[model samples]
Target: MSGGGSWRFECKFCNTKYVGAHNRVVSHLLKDGGKGVKVCPKVTPQQLANMSKLLNDCKERVKNAAPKSVPLPSSLRNAATSSLDYDMSFTCSNPTSSEVGLKKRKGMGTALEKAFQNNSKEQCDGEIARMFYIGGLSFNLARNPHYRRSYVRASNIPGYVLPGYNALRTTLLQKERKNIELHLQPIKDSWKAKGVSICSDGWSDPQRRPIINLIVANTNGPMMLRAVNSQGEVKSGEMIAELIIECIKEVGHENVVQIITDNASNCVKAGALISAKYHVIFWTPCVVHTLNLVVKNICAPSLQTRNNDDVYDACKWIRPLADDVSLIKNFIMNHGMRLVMFTEHCNLKLLTVASTRFASTLVMFKSLRK
Candidate 1:
């Protein structure tokens, strides 16, 4: 309250008193730089003390009500710990291609400029490590284990290594296999130029898995090797024919002069079709196999019994022993004339068996000789 009409005293803490008219009273009350002042008449000491205490309590309440303090973890020792001033990144005012090498990081979440804002050495190293660990696997950066080691070690990112390794190895294997196939194409082409022969037989391996091998020979020379047709599926004659045709086309049909094989009906039919289409002759079976066939037919019954006993024993003994040059030489040294006669006789028999078409003669000779 003031002495003037409809006026108020101003509290120094809150400058919310009447503006114009209360100026004089405000000045009088706060004469010393707006500090609180007191004026009273017939006032007791107890009353003055009570008034001062009330004013002090009001001031204290206002101070306490200003803003509530945020509770923090007890583990935080410093009160200023809550005032975390985030470090600011510096921007390059001008940058050139020479300063930063040109390469696009496609799947990277942030651009190099953003990742390494001011191009500090530490920041640049961090960015590179991240790129290698995250982008390397996908972009072929971590294809080598050594690169992966360097990246992981530099980045201190052990967690990212395994996934990156798997990605890198898978891509590498795929690439290596593709390259190998490309290199083998030249060998296939060479074989085609010289003409290839086919050797087809149905056989089972130790696991009883039926598979066929297609062998090719040089029409010009004695070089022969297996045919590696990755796309071949040999089920029937037509399927086999397709493989032959593909090989012919690869090397050229004229280069493929002949396909030498046995008289298996399917084999014969397949050869006939190939020869007809490619204008290549199919040669007859080997003479050695033909002799074996003649012998098998001749003594089917009698030789079957003998083959179980004497003939099998004689063959088991003679073939391997005679085939050994040292043994033959030793025999010649011991019985010179007789050994020479025997050698001549064996050669004559072999020639006769190879040339003759009679099955009975081979059987009679086998029985007489043994």
Candidate 2:
């Protein structure tokens, strides 16, 4: 209709005009919503089917004639999210070794793909969420320096190949360990002048084994010395003392100022033995442990009996009031609707009291008050 020589033909069905390319004219008549042009309202099911086949055939002819325009294989396109071997990376670019990211040219997409192209942030967030869900990783991991650093490094490196599993455990592990040790050398060296404290803590493993960890601390910071497994044996003074003595010897007895431990009877006995062995290295109770014990006594007094010796005996109302607060906390937290309402009125989160944590009752009280 636009030109005289069979060019720019008009759709007979919908009266929509287009240049006589079979794809545009047929697709316009087919009422396909994905195409940019308005769909033909008059298109029938039979006409749509025929036009779709014709469009596909036209695409096939164009693709056959233009092989260079075809996208890279799916394997290459998906390389963005997969692990890459280090050998595949270019040494010349000196890109940090990291997770693989796609390196193919970004170009035009279908109408639907283009519609979602601007949602790259959401897509990245979804992938991160999926990873956390699949691995059961802690949400706090997002706050870790290494977690953000890894993403930063990955973004800079395209088509990065991840190190092999064996390399990760053996070669790369040793390399990283050495690198960390090098950085810690100055801190370790400060032990000679600042006089590091040798602190020990005991934890029960899943198998009910007693694991004692020794930490060396100074003005510089703390570092893990080692962990000793008590193998279901009693955590007696002799056994625990032996581990602390070994650590002291390893660290050099002259460099150690004080031995810190929890107020457990066994740990107290161990500290006593260590003090007797080295007069210069005194024994001190862990401050946090002492604070936790004090909080427990004040907030959750014993109910078996009350006498003049009991601290809460004079303040008879403290125990029942504490129990009532605990009940209220549980009531609100256990019900979703109550919790939502509480959040709406007060932004403060309800913190459950924990025996191991210092001042947990005080923290819960503060939250409730706020």
Judging by TM-score against the true structure, name the best candidate: 2
Please give the lDDT score for candidate 2: 0.76
Best by lDDT: 2
lDDT of 1 by residue, 177-265 (tens): 78977876665667645566555545555665665555556544343233434334556666656666665675566666677665566
Clash count, one per candidate: 0, 4
Clashes of 1: 0
Whole-structure CA lDDT of model 1: 0.52
lDDT of each: 0.52, 0.76
Q: Candidate 1, which segments miss by more than 4 Å at Cα? A: 1-173, 182-186, 219-239, 283-370
Runs of candidate 2 with Cα error greater than 4 angstroms are: 1-133, 137-160, 204-210, 229-231, 300-314, 334-346
Task: Estimate candidate 1's RMSD in Å.
Answer: 31.2
lDDT of 1 at 35: 31
